[model samples]
Target: MTDARATPPPAEQRLHPWSWLFVLLQQLRQFVVPLLVLLFAGRRGDAGDFAEWAPLVGVGVLVMVAVLQYFTYRYRIGDDGISIRSGLLQRTQREIPFARIHNVALHQTLLHRIFGVAEVRLEAAGGQKPEAQMRVLGLAQALALERRVRHRGTAAAAGGGAEAASPAGDTLLALSTAEVVRLGLVSNRGMIVFAAAFGLLWQAFPERAAADWLQGFFREAMGYAGTLHLGWIGMAAAATATVGVFLALLRLLSVALALSQYHGFRLSEQRRRLTVERGLFARLRTSVPPRRIQAWFLQETLLHRWLGRRSLRIDTATGGREDDPRKLRELAPIAPPEACDRLIAHLLTEAAWPPPRWTPVPRRCWWRLFAGGVPWNLLLTTALAWNFGPWGLLALLWLPWSAYAAWRQAGRLGYAMDARLVAVRGGWWSRWWRLAEIDKLQALRLRRSPLDRWLGTASLWLDTAGAGAMSPPLCIRFLPQAQARALYAQLGRMLAARRLRW
Candidate 1:
């Protein structure tokens, strides 16, 4: 291997010739709402040229910034690392070693493909932003860099780097059209899309709140239904049918979105690194090492179970704290339960799927959970009764409903710790499993809340150095205090002597 210390500065390279255009569009997108607000608001008032000139000025500024960025940005790929230098007045330079760069993400909009270019982002741990981002680069150049980082870890000496780049790797999984449909049915992306569209609409008409518009529409619908002179039962049926139709349309939209988002989905492995490539018009391709994956998640909802499928995701060190739509955290968006099991087993040989023993929490904890929710149930009932008179007493039904749910959940709440992995399972209708390798753990602690202390119980909290920041934590809750302490100490011992692969 070449010595990095003695190496000279590598040749500096520029981005694609039309990089400025992409950068301009990206900048324009961020200010589109404000620009439109200014333009249209001006039109409504007495501002003559200001309306047209305001947007022009904003676009002009953005165009200059993008052009400046394109001209100033420079990068160098060396044997051991990559160096980047950019900025005009506030210049900054960064040197990122391959060992420190954990993920290489590439994206391509339809325009990018038309120009034979892609956007590149190099993500490392502990940073809120990507380590280095190239707005536009020749597709071939981006692929070469991805390969360089892929085999930089344990396989450097094995000639694994010489074989082929990202696309040539072995595909472990590929989603068919039917699977995409299943994924759509299981996902709530339609809601997210609707929310986004609603937000845009609100921004477009700042004075007209979405709530007001929706309320007006609902009132109109109610009046129209009353004009039908149908009986109460018929009206109820009509309302139910309307809701059902709306839900059906939402599901259909979700299906179309899933198909477009994951049209050519594939999960491949190269050396010890995993790569996911997906999207239709706008493509997203990302690669991260297995060692960077600190946690694994398996989700099976009521719908997923009925469909005979499940979802698998991983929390990787390279994942950013905030949700980035381009993030490829899903190992399997929707797959058969057996397929998910095999994939997990293959990806995590040490985890030992279906752990030999799943130790359930104290059975009596069910009462603790059931009683704990009583206050909220009572509060909800009281509010409803105050508003709706005696009929609101029906709200008390939630008490028993919640009690049964708590009982079932308490029964299913369990944890398993083997030599190499620790897994926690929770949830009732929407079940989940969070698994983390012992060696990958960053910290472990025994927690005791006031109520827990009063009840002589404690919780075992496990933390790892990766993403899943928004995911439910991996914790074994409501165990006897002493048992929790023992597990904490055992995990602490395991963590102390272990060596992190990444």
Candidate 2:
């Protein structure tokens, strides 16, 4: 063992003093809505005549509170570790060694951008919340700190500066502006429903102005034609849907514009690590090493399939903010088939994820999709229609929808297992490639419905624990009993090999 006295620690770097702007900004976000209500509502004599003076007093008090909170915030980075001192009523000090830092993220909301500040979130592998945060910091200082921490952290992880790669030499992958455009376009389809819902709610409650909770619900409902008249509702719903689709297209346009600024975005690889640096208005850099990855998946939606594209997702041991900082890495959209192959090869050991050893789903499963679901749904629809008149006919639509969905999954559902990998693909138009080392699986459950038992079929659901309360679940429906057991045994063996870390 080495002696602690043998080595001297390096000096510490104090973050920019302007970081207080972040605390101020955070206070603003939390207090603004209530403040606005107090001010405007009081203006109309809602709080009584004395309420007129309350806004001024309230504003002054709020400002003072914000200042005090900001004054109490501070962070320090030493050669050995990073220290953060924060919290308002209760003071908490957190120290994280450079070696344990998995990723660092810089985030700026519209408010932060206006103030020329950003938030720095430091993510560790095991914790749910960020290890620590310099809540508010000058944008420039935040970027500089990110560079410093990433370089130092990578150096520590590699054992010393001697093995640390240059910051510029570490990029592993990047998305071109064109590629970002493609990715954005494919995402447009999903946002249509969201936009339509918003529009319908706003349209419903014309009396209630935007941003009120009750008003928002009424507005979205009406905007989507939740109620009004049947003919008018249909027309409104159609119009709302159309508007939603268009807005989704516009969203993609904005993303494309943003990507153009980083047209030549690049990612560089060094040793077992990967780095991603991109964005124009606000730059971002994230780091992850291959060994820390829990899983890597490829998502190909109907739009992606039509466009011949795919999104890559890498799940890692790190967790904190929702962003990808804690992730192993998410590549820009790539060709579906190729992206699937590349991810599987990179994240899994050679012996674990060879070419898929796929087994076709049993034929009986197809009948379940057709006979079991559609008939019941259709029966419910017909009964509703019989009682409610022509309005009930809408329920009949279920038959067609279910028929289509089942038809799609019937030929598509499949499962494959190898020494190191398990892949399940089931979806009519959307194909998901979920790849994980057998050792990474947190739990395996074999379930059988009464129908499944009678049919000698079972469902296998796999999960990997993450910081989030709910980790993503991969469910394979209707595999043969024998096959499910075989897969379960294989997973158990792999987990045991790793001492059941799951």
The model with the greatest lDDT is 1
Task: Please give the lDDT score at residue 106 for candidate 2.
Answer: 64
Residue 277 in model 1: lDDT = 91
Would you list the C-alpha lDDT of every candidate in the order shown?
0.85, 0.65
Query: What tens-digit string does per-residue lDDT give for candidate 1 at 135-245?
Result: 998787777778777766333222223343334778888999899998898888898898899778888775557678888999998899889998899999998998899
My TM-score estimates for the predictions, one after another, are 0.91, 0.75
**What are the per-model numbers of colliding residue pairs?**
0, 18
Candidate 2 lDDT by residue in tens digits, 189-227: 335555787788887776456657776786786666646
- Total clashes, candidate 1? 0
Candidate 1 colliding pairs? none
RMSD of each: 3.8, 6.5
Those runs of model 2 whose alpha carbons end farther than 4 Å from true positions after fitting are 1-14, 46-50, 87-89, 108-117, 138-166, 189-266, 321-329, 334-336, 349-356, 370-401, 467-472, 500-502
For model 1, the run of ten residues with the poorest summed lDDT: 153-162
